[model samples]
Target: MNRTQFLRLCALGAALAVGGPAALAQTYPSKPIRLVVPWPAGGGADAVGRAVAEALRVQLGQSVVVDNIAGAGGNIGTQQFIRQPADGYTLLLATSSTNSANPYLYKRTGFDPVKDFTPVASLAVIPSVMIVAAGAPYKSPADIVQAAKATPGKLSYGSGGVGNSAHLAGELFKSIAGIDVIHVPYKGSSPALTDVMGGQLDYMLDTGAYGQLKGGKVRAVAVASATRHPLLPGVPTFEELGIKGMQMNAWYGLAAPAGTPAAIVERLNGAVQAAFQAGDLGKRLTDVGAELRPGTAASFAAFWNAELQRYAGLVKLTGATLD
Candidate 1:
């Protein structure tokens, strides 16, 4: 009602408007954060999501809850995550399936991987292993290739799903080895791997087959890495086995909705670096056959961009699609 009162109110309003983001950054993660994994629970993505969330909980002094929203090859959950507030409270545990391959495989994924998210960190690279039942006749990659060539479509391989890294790896193997192996797509890797172990499926290229291999439930013939994985040192790489043009590694990363505050992104990146430095997370990831690849937000963004380009080429080469 008075000039002095009006002036004081305006000054307070100006201060709040100007200092809002800075103040928020200083007191960020004041409440619980949601870490969305665009895949089903109990899968590799969910495991990695929980691991990163736990580490961030200790570093950020806030609860980081993992929420799984699986469907449409990770497109459903990714679209939902992109629609959340860009306040950094909601983050996505992104994988190669959602970020690189899905965009090319699906006719419409409803969100741009590069434009709709802000990279936070690159977590790890998971190498896929060619595995068969413990009692299968195929003892090596060459044996499997020869059998497929001799029998044509008599031999079949299972994958987590169509357009997934496992499927693409199998396709790449078929192309390079010049063999005809029927492809069986399951809803998830667990089921596909189960079939492989049960002898219903001849073999599968899977990233999460380490436990089965170690438990003697399945035998690994070859790894899709340039070198042998330390956990599976006895197994050889595809290159070492004379299999060319078949190197593929699935990766996991953390990202926030686009336009998230740079300060929040930087803080999250720092938390990731600290998580890797703690040594426990790296060891746990390695135990599951994942190679830790901790890096900055900018570095992750660059890597993600390159992955997009690379997967685009692979998609074209394999003629894999999900319309």
Candidate 2:
């Protein structure tokens, strides 16, 4: 071949060998990255999402912005999220409610939990607490159970919305404890928690309420975990209260849309690991009743898949559904 032809062939060969634009691109997150939180602002998941965005900002040297696309028990936001470009610029601040539990609870979740997203990192897990207004008659887990059994549907609990973690937790509590408490769904947890504190609702089970617990407005009846949380040292676990098969912990993780380059996914996972290792992200999340659960991309994927299966059974047991 001639000299010009030889150079052109060489360039073509290099381009072909390097594969697509995702493989050729060296700079990732060239612009501000969007972290989609399917829950409304001021909720527990939003807080976690904001924290992660800040961490990513420092680690990735790009502004990681939190976009609250809340509604429909996370289905609306997830639907919108899956439509974003899979270029690693747009990501998801995933939660158990959105990723695992909602599919089982809702008729159509808008996106397939496994096929529509790529797992980046497993960030943390927040244990749910069974909470009651401080001035309410019930003081302990047994007291709440007795009251529910006695009054049946008279006593009620509130949750942020149907198919939310709080709702799922309440369902599990009712099923395992054998109570007939009414479940009142609200627009968000803050309002639901407000009703709980005001005595409008008998109780609420969620990872939120840490702030209220400190102010003594709401009292924790029992943690849903098998062991007591360090943040809630005085609180007793349901297992401690002799209520077995009741463990509800909402998990948080990062994910990109499906078909995002694996290299980009790996890089994002590394940033997450680095963020968890450095910074007060761990402490900040822990302050909100979250325990750090950092892991690799593969590990996070496995955990995500397992959680999907577990929540499927849990949702089935609760008989909670939403559309």
Per-residue CA lDDT of candidate 1, range 54-80, in tens? 989988999999998878777888999
Q: What's the alpha carbon RMSD for model 2?
A: 4.7
Candidate 2 C-alpha lDDT tens digits along 151-209: 88999899888888899999888888888988999877888999999999999998888
Error of 1 at 151 (Å): 1.9
lDDT of 2: 0.87
Estimated TM-score per prediction?
0.92, 0.92
In angstroms, give how far residue 91 of model 2 lies from its true place: 0.6
Pairs with steric clashes in candidate 2: none
Per-candidate clash tally: 0, 0
Error of 1 at 286 (Å): 1.2
Per TM-score, the best of the predicted structures is 1
**Which portions of model 2 miss their true places by more than 4 Å?**
1-26
